[model samples]
Target: VLESFGSRGQDLSTEELWQKVLQEVTAEELRAPLHRLCALQAGWWLADRRLGSITSLFCLLRQAEDTGRARCSQGENKLLYLLKAWQVPAEEASLPLVQSAEDLKETLCTSAAFLQGLLELEAENFPTAFSLLKEAAGGFCSKRVLAQIYTCLGCCAQRMGKPQTALQHLKQALQVDFQCLPALSHAAAVYHELRETDAELQALALLYEALEKNPPGATSSNPRFLMQTELLVCTPVLASLLRDRHPSEVKYLLAQRCLQDGRVADAVEHYLDVLTLLQEGPQQQVPLVGSSALPRIPEVFLEAASALEQAGRHQDAITVCEEVISRTTDLIPRMLRVEEELELPECPSPGEGLAGLSQKKENLRCLAWRAAGYLHQGWARAVLGESKEAITQFSRCLGDLLRVQLCGSGVGLTENPLPEVEVLQKIRLLSLIGRGTQFLELGKHKEALLDFQHGLQISPGDPAAISYLVLALWKLDRKKEAAAHWLKISQSPPREDEQVGRSFPLYLMSCLQQAVFPHRESLSSRLQDYL
Candidate 1:
């Protein structure tokens, strides 16, 4: 009859075979076969699928026990054991007495506590769950059972807002079984909550690997396989969870991970998704858990453009930069109008109103973003060897930045209103460096010297600007000035320790040597040795 239920590849369904067996088998004969069926159903229950068969098997076993079958005691004990583990509302009077002589009594007790803990956890009674699960974990002898127990404890700790303890439990669970999906997933959530992005990604990477290795349909016994298939079956639930949890940030982090791993194309796609979510406005915005603000949209767009440039997609980088520029331009006119209106006699408060102050600061931010866009555009042009066009872009960037500085100065705002002062300074320095390099390439040595001098004034320790200044002075026939600059460069901090790379200095020295004295190999060798 069990073979007819497909135990040995019979064609009949379980329900059909069971009905036929019910007609022929007495309660005594049915107990053994029924126990076998319940064991099979229990495996499905562990995998968290097909509860119907498990429920039916439990009912059949209960019927045999109630009918006073002589040999049904073992089957009755098995049913009680499973009920305790499942946290079913079984009558204590009907529960089979724990046989002290049984070899597996401890295991049965541990399993019961673990399942009851899981039930409490499902009901959101975390403290009780924690206590019960902890006790269960102490009694577990099997590594697999212990791993599950620890994972439940971790879940309880996490719910109780004890992330550190939760992480410890999760780590123990993983140590017991590296492929434990529940532990890995919970670890990822805990690390994310702790703002340990790198650790979160590490856990997620392991989880993904486990999912791939134990794909659904490979086997039903592996819980992860069942979970993976269920996740695919109910994608909307997954989507809802992702939507509520600020998936944009997760996508951004994943993009950063992909970029770090040299998966540039994947990073680009993820970055684009982040930008799309931002552009869709506040309704589409998912509030960051434990954070008050979303990521700055302009900064994200700039980063995306940079990633595109790194992937050698120059045109795409330029397009993104142009979008930033256009967006900033559109806001500038509105901000200027607001500023003008605030200055009008009709507005008694002037800049005292919060709205006015906010608009003013936003104007400054837009100007800074515009300058940044130009700086990025200049870099793209420079990388493509368009020196003249690059010079134009750099000049525009410097002009915009100077205007921003002038506006800040005129506002009687002793401090920089925008929190992007450092960013503005970086863009200014890059503009100077780019323009200086272009001027040197165009043989406008004096102009190059002036740009380099301005850059050095902004950042005295900058090696690239200093090296370029020396070359520019030399080309202009200022021998004394060139020698003094060379001495200064030599006395400056070691180039190796500076943020600028050695290649810039090497290239500058090579160009100077070729342009001034191509035949003076001895002089060039001395310069190389000094470098």
Candidate 2:
């Protein structure tokens, strides 16, 4: 009788429940019901990122598992689960319980072999591990063997600048074991190299699954393990997104805390900002570890789209939707389309008023990803046009996203892969202001004005929020009153980056085209200079 709690591999946070499952597991319970969480190295060698020697740390854990470091299976299982949650998928994952001492040793050896190679490669000893893993793959070894084989090869190819080829091997690794750390790692790298950022983000979620805990206790005779966290997950590439840089680390840590506190949307925005900082190309104004091979351009594009869509910028949403659709023939395009449609005026409020049940039903295929796609599209659309469509798109995108954000998924779709305090703040601000912006675009000026006002309260001195308030008031025939708010934005710039700065140029250009605002050459020069 295994004494673990909850429903076996159905969840991740099962520490306490696993402790109870040691009572004794039945023969029937030895099959697919047994879920294991193994640890993959969170930190490893790359361009310029380090996390407390995470590679070596995982190696240490492997040693402990092999050498009988823990007396009881409970301790071993807990440690194993933590490791797996961290993204290391073991070959022995689906194996039955060890009935005898030798059986235990056999399992330990199998786990060790895979983990050893993982650590070696992560530690930058690719040549050494590759030779060994290759030798093992020749025999009828575990899927882990094949996973390591192809993944390592893919990584090598990626570093050598053969992205298309690297993608092939990486995909094979994933085929062998979707949750395999090496496979996921290489796949993420390859996707970024190929500019298939949507794929990269999805693969990244698998990395996070390794760290998640299974909830709900399982029924078992022996309480060897617990399954308190019912949300069984794939894995997450946590450390890959963060480097040793202080700002990056801080941002990621902040995002983690926010996620743990049940603020996922906020966390998503934080990471997006961080990703922007990370994606600023090699010649960034702020020095953060931005990689040449990183899919920063696509990632930033997606993040902006999401932010704008959430803020209800229909035109911005359309722009991102087009870009995403144009770039890939993958499922994301279909998903973004659903969001684009939902942004339409006749779609009704989030909870009621729409007759698009069939459309929503169709989107149910991959609601989470679809919701995420819409999130990106809305933000992008907001940037290209007036607030109306963008606002609607942003609202619908978020509504769909929140509707299916799996309780504790800790999901984020942003340029900044790491979430921090600033990211979370931005998320909240964006969510509120995005909704407000939608109202403004829809000609519900009073409603938009109120929403903007509320957003400003949350972010007291946010220049963007102030600008939004001004826009809302102006649309509501309160142009004279809105001037005071513009004073705030002119004096203090919130986001002065190219993306944020584009808003300034765009607004001026719009005014110039329509002759709505007055400004001769000298005045315009002053305006340009001030901006």
lDDT of 2 at 186: 57
Model 1 — TM-score against the truth? 0.50
Candidate 1 C-alpha lDDT tens digits along 25-138:
555544544444444444445344344554555555455355443332542334334444332222235545332112133443454455556666777788877887786787
Reference-based lDDT, residue 41, model 2:
19
How much is the lDDT of residue 364 in candidate 1?
Answer: 65
What lDDT is reached at residue 271 by model 2?
50
Task: Give the per-residue lDDT of model 2 (tens digit) for 185-229.
Answer: 556656766766567656655554442321112112332322110
Q: How close is candidate 2 to the true structure, as a TM-score?
A: 0.29
Candidate models: Cα lDDT each: 0.60, 0.44
Per-residue error for 478 in candidate 1, Å, reads: 2.9
